[model samples]
Target: MTIRVVVADDQALVRTGFRMIIDARDDLEVVGEAADGEQAIRLVRRTSPDVVLMDVRMPVVDGIEATRRIVADGAAARVLVLTTWDIDEHVLGALRAGASGFLLKDIRPTELVDAIRGTARGELPLAPSVTRRMLDRLLRTAPRMSAPDGLESLSQRETEVLTLVGQALSNAEIARELALSEATVKNHVSAVLRKLGLRDRVQAVVAAYDCGLVRPRRP
Candidate 1:
């Protein structure tokens, strides 16, 4: 199935560039474009695209608010936030607002395309260089000092799986680290998310950090 997308950025050039690359892919299609967050929401509602390439700094409304509204309304479209700054606090806001993942604006075309596909598939696509710092900041600044009620339900093995996931390790990688079958790791991951009341792995990552289940790597 073609992955339908909407590119919402204030710059015409950025939108055009994304549209060009996306349309070149046989499995991807650019269904619409919007110049700002408000337009993005309208376009999303109108097209019901599988994914949205959302820019965080748009006028009229910021991407974080737009994402919050979209998720709150229970729309099927998933948001993939794109920004020039990888470590911007807005990235955290966007994630908390229900973005599937985030990408640096300078990401390679192929990576961007892959991120779009991954987001559509309900996978998180964090920028490699920013994950550690982002998670660290999330740990420090996330509002709650204690674990959420559902978080305590995770088993010890499940907690370990969640920590690796917060580290942004893929299922195969997690399996390799834990000496478990990939299927078992997948089941653990599913249980972790289900028990934590998270929407996807991205939220799980945030929760893992927020609850101090994962720690930052030393420099």
Candidate 2:
């Protein structure tokens, strides 16, 4: 199936560049383009794309607010936040606001395409550099004060899955670590999300950190 996408960035050049890369893929299509968050939201409502490439620093409404509003409005499109700064707090805000993934602006074209596809598939495609920094900040700022509500609802296996997810491991990686099939790991991940009342894997990651199931690596 062709994955429809909307590229939302303030720079016309960036939008055009992304559009070119995306449209070159047979399975990907650029259905709309927006120069700001509000326009992005409007395009999403109209085109119902599978994924949205959102720039965090866009003017008027900002990517975080746009993501929040889109999720609040129950739009079907999953948001994939893009930013130049890997450690920007706005990236975390965007994820918390319901973005499905985050990527640095300098990501390779192949990786960006894969991320878009993965986000559409409900996979969290956070960049490794960004993930470490984001989680470190989360650890320092949010700390593991207490378990998030609904955490206890997860079974032992589900908890394990959540822990791996928080560590930014993909389903295949989680499966390998737990000696389970990828399909089984996928089911466990779904269960973890459902039990924890998370919108997606990004929220699951946050929940994992919040519940102390995952911790920052010691230097």
Tell me the TM-score of model 1.
0.89
Task: Give a tens-digit lDDT track for model 2, residues 1-219.
Answer: 999999999999999999999999999999999999999999999999999999999899799999999999899899988888766778877877788878888889999998898788876665544665566764565435556678878888888888888888877888889999999998898888877767778778877887887777653
Candidate 2 residue 200 C-alpha distance from true site, Å: 2.8
lDDT of 2 at 208: 81
CA RMSD per model (angstroms):
2.3, 2.4
lDDT of each: 0.84, 0.84
Q: Model 2, stretches more than 4 Å misplaced?
A: 126-134, 137-148
lDDT (Cα, tens digit) per residue for candidate 1, span 1-219: 999999999999999999999999999999999998999999989999999999999999999999999888788898888889766778888988888888888888998898888888877665534655555654455464456568778899998998898887888889999999999999999998778766778877777766877766654
Instruction: Write out the backbone clash pairs for model 2.
Output: none
Clashes of each: 0, 0
**lDDT score of residue 118 within candidate 2:** 78
True lDDT of residue 159, candidate 1: 88
- Candidate 1 residue 77 Cα shift, in angstroms, is 2.0
